[model samples]
Target: MSRLLVTGGAGFIGSNFVHHVMEHSDDEVVVLDKMTYAGNAASLEGLPESRFTFVRGDICDRELVDRLVSGVDAVVHFAAESHNDNSLANPEPFITTNLYGTFALLEAVRKHDVRYHHISTDEVYGDLELDDPEKFHETTPYKPSSPYSASKAGSDLLVRAWARSFGVRATLSNCSNNYGPRQHVEKFIPRQITNVIDGIRPKLYGQGLNVRDWIHVDDHNAAVLLILERGEIGQTYLIGANGEQDNKTVIEKILTLMGQPADAYDHVNDRPGHDMRYAIDASRLREELGWEPTYKDFDAGLAATVEWYRANEGWWRPQKAAVEAKYAAQGQ
Candidate 1:
């Protein structure tokens, strides 16, 4: 069985990857997570003890990273300061974690000669015009608009440089927006879902015309596994499911599926420097790796996500007040 060290494995995508690896392959997983506000230990509950282990630590810890890298056949780097709003408020953590933390992991993998995969977002390519038909691809020029995207952009460059200069066995994937079970309430989909669950009207950003290419977290992780296993080293793959929809339509879908009026949501001031659109062209991943998303229908995925929040209120409730409070403070 392949042994994997999954950084940020308690967070939404990483936890799902751990579960996916366990369920789909004969792999043992070691989860290295900092247990940030974004990472929840409970999300990783019920992993088979025989095949799974969780370590509470930061990816910035080079010694720990080296020790962990020594034991794993591969390292899937997912730890990052991911919230855009939080990054705008305080960019220090983003610089420290996204850049330096990635540096540490790269060094460890280079030293240990382990296979590595970096998870990134299409936000690194900045926004496209609402009418633009082009999507972010492997060769898209970097034009990050926010601290979060800039930091991620820098991280992706680091992986590329390490692969070429130091010959680190690494591949990278930049995925579009992801929505599914176990997502933190602060993210767009979960925020609206939890808000609706609390008898509060969902909040939409100004006009809600901004477009995002959404992909189910499971589909994203499935593609990640394919890349980690069979993708070309030093190559970049874009992971998308051709699920592009505007924010207005996504919110309305959530509301309608939740048995509420599509117009029940309220429009709030949009965040500063909000990207107008983010689209990903995953033709390389699909054609090269033969990957496909199981949740071909967005409505079906949103329905499942809504049910997850309804059934696991305890998992999201404790973080709800604080997340909304932070947003309220920002007047978002």
Candidate 2:
């Protein structure tokens, strides 16, 4: 069985990936997380002690990263300061964690010669116009608009450099928006879901015309595992489910599923530099790695996600007030 080191294992997508691996494979996982506000140790509770281990540490710590990389068979880099609004408010944390943090992990893996895979966002390719027929592809140029996307773009380059200059076995995948359980309420999908649950009106951003290519966390993680197992070294794959919907449609669906009127939500100010649309072209990943998404229906997957927040309010409750208050201060 393989032993994998998953950075950011206590956070949203990382935590879901950890659960996916535990349930679907025999591989053991050693999770290194800093317990950031977005990181929840409770999401990782109830795993088999023998197969799971959680380490509270920073990925920027080269010594600690080296010790962790020395033992694991592979390192899956998922740790990042991922909230765009926070990045706009303060960009330094994003630079330190996403860029320099990736450098530390690359150095460690290079020293130990371990398999590595870097997880990144499609925002590095920038936004598409509402009328454009194009979707982001493997060859898309980097045009990061926000501090968060810029940091990630820089990190992606670091992985490519390490693989070529040092011959470290590495692969990269850029995925579209992800929504599932254990996600922080600060995110778009969960915020609306929880807001409705608390008898609060759901808020939309500027006319809610922004479109996002949505994918379930399970689908995204499944593709990551596929690339790790069979993908060629130094290759990049794009993971998408073809689930594209505007903000208004998503909020309306959530309201309808929650037994409310479709127009029950309110519109608020949009975040600066908001992308108009983000679509992913996953032809390469499917043709090369034979990967396909199981959650093809956006509404069905979204309904299930809404139910998750409804049933697991205890898990998302503690952070709800703080998240809303932060948004309130920003007048978002």
Candidate 3:
């Protein structure tokens, strides 16, 4: 019965979290989202507006954030500029939204004295050396390279600082790559899925050897609920499904699930300064909070996701075309 304020609740993971919360608990959820390019209201279709409230606003608006944080028992902060390519093209929004937006949220929490949960990415830990590439723990030193990761790192530090300085109830979680239905086409998995379905090549970056720890969006949402309910204040938790796959390997798996072949896609130039790998040590989350994902294997999840996109063409067609048009215009 918690009154929860979920920032970015219209995006893929956030929308999934909202649905998860609605199904698993009786808590009242108020979703505050800017409804950016990646934030689609369709993701939350059929959700009742009575129990679930939606507010169109940016996290950087201190007054709006303060007003929204008021009367809410907790805040799950997820609003941000998440696309690395867009961040590379323009880092201003990432700085403003990720960094200052987090600051504003922290201030609101400090004033209201509510529980704050900061959602972050594994990129903040930077590239793992190929030789080891061992799982990243909570105390791992942050070595962000790109503007997006750097901004997330900045926000992470700000959250911890607020916990120490102002005694705010702040908890942060860094997660690996999430793949599931309703994901934006710009992300790797969805992009590949839509491309293959549309008779376009699934573009591979570099030799496609870069690895990422994968987690289903449902798993991520469940882990966040566990953290919000039972996690320690002033602590950080890493959430991953322990499903690690390299870029080419993931593409091949998706193709197999879709009855396609590796030859369906062509190798493309790698992005400059792309991190080779990102993994997370989720042991703390499991041992501390008893949070182990039901979807431990990505193969079945990927198959289901592929089937979903195949059946939901009307939902993704326009968005996919717009994304492809943007890339084509850029000569990418």
Task: For residues 159-250, write the lDDT of model 1, one tens digit per residue.
Answer: 99999999999999999999999999999999999999999988898999999999999999999999999999999999999899999999
Q: What is the overall TM-score of model 2 with all chains considered together?
A: 0.99
Off by over 4 Å in 3: none
What ordering of candidates by lDDT runs from best to worst?
Answer: 2, 1, 3
Candidate 3 lDDT, 1-332, residue by residue in tens: 79999999999899999999999999999999999998998888888777899999999998999999997999999888998889989999999999999999999999999999999999999988767847799999999989999999999999999999999999999999999988988889989998988878888887999999999999999999999999999999999988889999999988878788766777877787899988889999999898888887789889889988888888787788789887777655
In candidate 1, which residue pairs clash?
Answer: none
Best by lDDT: 2
lDDT of each: 0.94, 0.96, 0.91
Score every model by TM-score: 0.99, 0.99, 0.98
Candidate 2 lDDT by residue in tens digits, 67-114: 999999999999999999999999999999999999999999999999
Indicate the residue-level lDDT of 98 in model 3. Answer: 96
Worst 10 residues of 1 by lDDT: 323-332
Colliding pairs, model 2: none
Model 3 RMSD to the real structure? 1.0
The whole-model C-alpha lDDT of candidate 2 against the native structure comes to 0.96
Clashes in candidate 3: how many?
0
